[model samples]
Target: MAPPAWTTRPNAKDDLRERARELRRQHRSVPEVAAELGIAKSTAYRWVRDIPLDVDARKALFAREHSSTTGHGQMMAEARWSEYRAERDARQAERVTGAAGSVGGLTQEELVRIGAMMYWCEGAKAKPWNSTRRITFVNSDAGLILVFLAFLRAVGVEQSTIDFRVQIHETADADAAVRWWAAKVGADRTIFRRTSLKRHNPKTVRYNTGADYHGCLIVSVRRSRAIYDMVEGLVIGVVRAAGRPSAPCDPWPQ
Candidate 1:
């Protein structure tokens, strides 16, 4: 027993707590600090429970890990492509310099009109009595929210203006899902409103969690013109990026 006591090590919780305190002092995140110290995320959380943090430590951590060097690389790539687009647009504009009086091809006004039409047709909600200035899409698929958000941004809608709400079954993991989506879009949880849907039959097969859940997001446009233009650019830019030709069509084609 004495030999076994000699071989045993003392509890290191105090050491871990001290290290965690130091990391917090240096503005290190719980997850990063945990990873560095070979501890669990929960342990890190517990250690920092009593400590006060000026900013959201968890989010700060996630952004540092996910949006650091990799995010910069992607941004640089996008910037290079944007420059190429500007050059191409200038060349195209030069070609149509003679047709300035007429709205012929690849003009700024034409682009704006095209973008408006595209947003009206695809993104905006249409009703028999009135066309609501909102975009509604159905999905039970996972990760669609992120895709939709990216699309909105591509079309010119600022992330700040976008709102999100989740419609889920009453018994489902609605809270968890909302948290996950919030983290994904880098948006605050307050932006999400959880609604309950009653299921009459309890025996029916349904996806309750993970990627299989059947849920949809209600996306609304507070600024219609801006949203429309953004969407139009997104469509044209995507088509051009794919090396395909896209012509603007009528909003209410006969």
Candidate 2:
């Protein structure tokens, strides 16, 4: 039999065309066949355009194209979301700053009330089952710690009687944290009890890492038996004053 038409061509074009067609028949994509054969995609497609893909081949092509397009679209969406988040965060910050400005210096009574409420939420309390008045507060927030100190001062609690130490994971920079806490709370290193080191857990994924992580400060006022009762009274007063009218209780004792 006479050789097929393409074998008589003077150059490799005939071989490339046949190879491109063979790849297309084997379900290879136009770009893949063009790349292997060193031909333009358009030229590859022109050669293989008449080759019909079966249902599975069409589905595979669709999946590949969809995956590429979806990936590109997702990246664009993430970029837009990042921009939106920054703008939203900035606007929220402005509102927060404005709201903060509305609050001027707190009065002694206000501090007492605020501190009592704050302590009730985060501080150790004496339960009815086992009653012992011990005033202890632990927190990681610097602002709360500072406010609590102010509250103690307003209530006439001497600073000397207060005991403080940091509680942190053993993996953290314990020395740096101690120094940071000393400067932050205006306390001497000599005063703080030995820091409480938590044993590290290999299974845990900890997010509270980095230079800013100073660990939680544990503050306990020695000889606080009386102060505990006073705080309890202050918290009760606030509850009575702010209590809703629905509950049948004697109108807060005058």
Candidate 3:
């Protein structure tokens, strides 16, 4: 025989009330508990409305919710940052392209000024204590050497009057470096002096090595006192002009 309706109905209601209480303990809203239990909202409220929340339980629930939200926010922030970087890089590239277009060719006067500046910084200076006058340019950069050679040519210095030398670590490929520099500066290999070798310490690490490491080149002009004097004057003039209130002439002579 079937059980009485009163007995079964009360049991089902009791189970639903217990589930609602458990949901409240988990810090779920009354509406959410009601929806999950498939019970009437009024019944759900009646079951859990009087329950007081514990501080620790509330904090746990907030943490769970915040974790989900934080992941989404982080992704959105990263996407926006990527877009900003791409736009900035594009603008920089456009500026570089415009600058390249503006520099068509350098005038003789511009080369003279630039050459003097390079010499003043990289070439040996005649100090009051040591007064040896010579147009000696030393650099590791091949491009700078080529510019110096061009400057010398512009000022009517013959190719025969220039001498080349290499200073490098004994551990490096001296012959290979001389060959590379000769090709780079468009000079005869025979003009190069015996490569000066410095003792290399095993404990010291060197960044410059391998195929790309062409050691420093020394380009000395024979009987260059007059040229050296002229370069000194040009450097002094450039410095004085820089100090003046008036804007210096366009560094790039047309």
Q: Scored by Cα lDDT, where does model 3 land?
A: 0.87
| Pairs of residues clashing in candidate 3 | none
RMSD of 3: 14.5
TM-score, per-candidate, Cα-based:
0.38, 0.68, 0.62
Q: Pairing residues by index, what is the TM-score of model 1?
A: 0.38
- Tens digits of lDDT, candidate 3, 143-234: 88889888998888988889899988899899998999889987789889888888999999899988888889999999999999999999
Candidate that scores best on TM-score: 2
Most lDDT-accurate candidate = 2
Candidate 2: segments with Cα more than 4 A from true spot = 1-71, 244-254
Clash pairs for candidate 2: none
Rank candidates by TM-score, best first. Answer: 2, 3, 1
